[model samples]
Target: MVRVAERLDAVAAGLAEQEGPEAHAALADRTIEALRALRDEAGAADWTAAAVPAVRAHAVGALMQVCPLTRYAFARPRGYPGDAGLLDLIYRHPDADGALAEASAAGRAAYAVTSGTAPCAAVRERRRILAGAIDRAAAERPGAAVLAVACGHLREAEISAGLRDGRVGRLLATDQDRESLARVADRADAPAVATRRLSVRDFIAAKATAEAEIGRFDLVYAAGLYDYLDDRIAARLTRKLFGLLRPGGRLLVGNFLTGLREEAYMDAVMDWQLIYRTQAQIRAFAAEISEVDLAGANYWADSAACVGYLELEHA
Candidate 1:
């Protein structure tokens, strides 16, 4: 704890000496590099000497006063890390522009660098890819049915022409947070989208009920959920989602890759944590489903190379 505190103090002291956005941005960049190194070293040692939780909390409190994006994530109105709102901030959704304007000098400096990082850029790309996938599915199967598991705010739907034009027979979205579902429900395109307020656990446990109620889908995908799941749950969820697919349907699952430039900032400042996977590790999850004959299986990363996706298609 003392060592972590010292590191935090060093970062604070360095920032204190800087004035103007340029200086603050430079300081933020350097500080993040140092923090990433410290995090890597601690993880290598199995985190025995790293009081990660304490250090993260302290950093979050300090950054919150200066960084609006970090502050909003730490607040986590959904009572968990990686809420949709946080992603909206990272993606710079139109609504986020107003919030950016209200940021403090330090916050603006932090945002300038953090928001432009590879990870943030990749997140926005991921959303676009998801929308493209939906469009392809709908194009292949007229009036295609789609399912978004643990869908956070379902922002990708906004970019999907299929959903907007009612070509998608139905877009079923499930999330534990009603507030997120409420936002999806309130969208102008609400008529074409259906939402269910249920946690992933409940959906997984009651697969039979879900199958009966929601019916099979042409495209089933999950984003921002597998990162928090362990291997066992991810494998189980994969098998279950596979079962929910119609013949020739596709299942796409996403996970952050091993190297993320903003990882340290996410850990230390936003107190957000995720389980990253390598290409091989992501493929291993797909291998768990031995019962199905996969028509195709492939892995791809976002343009920024910060997020990896495993796509499986049922024959």
Candidate 2:
């Protein structure tokens, strides 16, 4: 949504040179410059220590939508503003370090400080999506176990965190890297959320097996996981997760709206944002499930239909 509009705006801004492969690099550079400032203002708020993901979500969502690249497509874990490195490659790639730096510099510039409450309409919608995902799990399995795939640092999303902690019953958590989740787990006040490393094999497990590892969870969510996989993997992962749902279980996926500009800038349309799903695609996924509920209730004014989640239930 926002991505296409931004490219239009960018082309509008730089009509003369908005063409060729060079367009992506040029747009990337402009986006980098913008994100760096946005992040700096975010840092100044000192919320990174408390509302890390929210802050990131707000800053990044706003930046991504307004810019030419989709947030998730250009997303790098632990914070890259303009491109998601592949799961395994992210860990081994030497470029990972540089990308992190890129996130820092570019993210800061991209975000602008506002005097009022978050102007990005998407943030509140994201929170709602999170709440709904949690609620769906609870509703499906009265006492289904829960897990936190990646809690990140802020540790502020406690309701969801508590659900992951065994404190709420059976729970487990997994992350490609442990440090971030550990930051939440290590807290003296940390809830009893069981924690583990995320693995590719776990993705393909049967419903019972998945529940056995994390307990009988009625819902399996990939809040920020979309950014890590390509369309092939995304579809495959969706199929895998579909198998993990109990007869009536659901799997939820999050997508960023707008700002995947690497290709959209000058008519290139590079849709690399964490496997973005259109309304039609969501309808298709719904058809696969015994029941499907797709909601677009939450969105930043600037976001292009990315702040919603898809619910797929097994018969």
Candidate 3:
């Protein structure tokens, strides 16, 4: 591990010294190959956690800056992981195009690989599914009201037909980041979307007041937030969100599945860590909601099998 860390440090030093985008690109390619080789050689000993020590020890943060996604995470502009901007890069949203355009060749190269990974692809799909769920709920419930917890950038609204056509009478999009809420408010269809700056912690604590303030929603979902929560918090949040749903309303939660292909890279290189859950574990969230009607609850993985989903319907 020490030797590998030393080799990575040498490569990182070279990458840091490279001035032009082309030089950075070349060095990034070489560094990526080296990391991949090292990861493969580590066999299945939880390389993500194992590599963290080396990442810190070798001061390879400079090398990781080559990837825009990793750099944003490592930099923590919002002082946290899975920020709205990071999701833009993952979803390949137009919002991220300017950042991509300004990125160095090395950053772009790393982003190309990062954005094309299985988990990233699954995230894109998850957004689509969530959008579709919104449309379906609107169709079933006239003037349906929807709530998106921790709605970063609320990019899924771009692809939502319900929001586009104004079928969704009201969609409350809330996030802890006021900047993210501002971006969502600035969207072309902002009238149809209401932005709120609320954190899960606040929502969980003020359950009664939150329910009274937001009113009942036909569809409520948390797409990426569950990844940061533990089983206890997730289960409790699940129950709370379920309570906010109107009769016949639905609740959906998404999580990265365990054993994701890019788990190691994301943890060690990008400084992103998720509490990955299996399908069974995800279903357990719904099961814990004993007070709710969970007959319609179901769990499944995205097509890429990199993401798991839990959906519950209130009878």
| Tens digits of lDDT, candidate 1, 1-315 | 236667766766776676677666775676677677767767745443464555665653365446667788767777899888888898888867888888877788878787788877888888999999999998899899899998888999999988877788888898988888898888737466899887767766875875788789999999789999988888888888887888889999999998876687777666788998898888877766764468889898887778889999988
Q: What TM-score goes with each of the models?
A: 0.90, 0.50, 0.86
Looking at model 3, residue 39 earns an lDDT score of 67
**Candidate 2 wrongly placed segments (more than 4 Å):** 1-110, 113-124, 139-142, 150-156, 159-167, 188-192, 205-211, 257-275, 283-304
Question: Which lDDT tens digits does candidate 2 get at residues 27-98?
Answer: 445544343333344442442342333323432234343332233234444453222233212222243344
Candidate 2 has an lDDT of 0.43
lDDT per residue for candidate 3 within 1-315, as digits (tens), equals: 435677676776666655655555555456556666666777556465566667545555465576787788777788899898998988888878998888877678767766777888888998999999999987887688999999998888888888888789899999999899888888747466888888888777875765798798999999899999998888888888998888889999998888765665676667788898888888887656775466588788889888888889888
Q: Pick the winner on TM-score between candidates 1 and 3.
A: 1
Q: Candidate 2 clash total?
A: 36
TM-score of 3: 0.86
Q: After aligning candidate 1 to the native by TM-score, how far in Å is the CA of 300 from where it should be? A: 1.3
Report lDDT per candidate. 0.80, 0.43, 0.80
